[model samples]
Target: MDAAVAEAHVAALQGEDAHAAEPFRMSAVKFAMWLFLASEVMFFAGLLGSYLVLRFSHANQFSEEALALNWPLATLNTVVLIGSSLTMALAVSAAQAGQAPRTARFLGFTFVLGVVFLVVKAIEYSTKIHHGIVPSMSLFYASYFTMTGCHALHLIGGLVPVTVVGLRALRGRVDGGKVELVGLYWHFVDLVWIFLFPLLYLI
Candidate 1:
């Protein structure tokens, strides 16, 4: 009888263990992307903080350098980036809806807009360089180039994934989650530009 009671208790414990709930889990890709973006946010925050400090220390120089920037052209680029964000959102929507062709079309639009932004930015840089307004010219110019250059690099990095996913979408081999992940990254890039344009150009 004692042996049988011990065996029954062991069986009950085993059953409880077998029925236990599993630990929570998140998608590895999503978790990684969010972590990456968080680190990027801190990095950009540091850059913007340093820029503000420099701007305050050399107010007059900043104002003088601001004159060299073409706000009108930057405004146009702002519009272009904003348009790209719209297209990216549409691509995500279409992808979620399982509309492969529509997703591809929107993604193509987004890629073109991104290229236009880079081209316009290159033109701006060329104009500045033509006037001998290099980064070594002033603290303001250094800050301007550093911030905008970092931003451009991020945008360029985002474009690669956008191209890959867009091509896959065209082939009907893309998933909504993949497009959504790219959209999150692309939106972050666009948002960084939105902050940068007003700070480095208008203000």
Candidate 2:
């Protein structure tokens, strides 16, 4: 019944039902999500292109002076993120199996992992600020901070929805696909960091 209601709600919003009160579909909500993610991919592509141009332009100047970010800590955070993705997957599986308690358990764990990720990021950003490498300082750090800071802000945005979904799950009110939908976005953010980590810190 919820699926039917979800479909009806989406079709009404998209005016699809007016054309044809037809069979069920992925719904407008899911379609909009795909559109949003596609736009995000393009956005990141532009930022990456800018970063690469700056990197080559400054190779001979400050190449050796990289803040030498805490590689081990970043690597650990990567593991944590990947683990959260797996836990999110498990939440979906438990929901499919009709196990609300287990689903909530996994979802709650993933949310806590997100919080841990933010805390680690705070430490990382604090270190960068401590060394006086503001974005206006140099061309290299300028682009680095701008690109990475934008990514961080998106990550925070992703966390907000995930936190809300987690709270709903705790009360057994959240749908499985809601968890899956938010998880999809959360995982994409993690995947972006997988690329940005090496580009900004290691390379």
Candidate 3:
């Protein structure tokens, strides 16, 4: 989308501001969310860098360790995350259209999918633990635990804001920009897993 158009969209969502020098630019909330997402990009980049280095240096061990991962379960979780992203997008679209009920329902579906992804991840983790595969087991296992565990933690952390947004949507208080902001974060989380899935499981 054109930058000006995107700016206008955000401005519309935030409502016209009387005190601003330039009107219909971008909302403060959306600006801050983009900055926050930039930081998150750097954080995940560092983790992925470290993981790639370890994997390259210990290729044989990493390959062997990767075999223990439950590919079927991880694939299912990936599908769940993808579905959540779809619902999140719908929620944003609904909110933009001022359809509060539809927005709330879509947000609820997204939340449920997020929970299901985490539950599937938990099952995978338990199986690994049962097989004595843990961070202390080896360097490969350590990287696996660190990367996947961090992503899972993020998913857990995301539940709070998603729940709040969903509740606000139900109560008819959510604005378009707010839903878009939350959707951006939710999509980023899902995108990270898209990169992670093949790296940790399929590779």
Instruction: Encode model 1's per-residue lDDT on 30-127: one tens digit a residue.
Output: 77888899999999999999998888888888977787699999999999999999999999999999999999999999999999999999999999
lDDT of each: 0.91, 0.77, 0.90
lDDT tens digits, residue span 98-174, model 3: 99999999999999999999988888888889887779989888888899999999899888888999999899887
Question: Highest lDDT, which number?
Answer: 1
Instruction: Provide TM-scores for the models.
Output: 0.86, 0.80, 0.86
List candidate 2 stretches off by more than 4 Å: 1-25
Instruction: Give candidate 3's error at residue 83 in angstroms.
Output: 0.7
- Model 1: how large is the Cα RMSD against the reference? 6.4
Residue 87 Cα positional deviation in candidate 3, in Å, after optimal superposition: 0.2
lDDT (Cα) of model 1: 0.91
Clashes of 1: 0
Model 1 CA deviation exceeding 4 Å by range: 1-26
Clashes in each model (backbone N, CA, C under 3 Å)? Answer: 0, 0, 0
TM-score of 3: 0.86
In the predicted model 1, the residue pairs found to clash are none
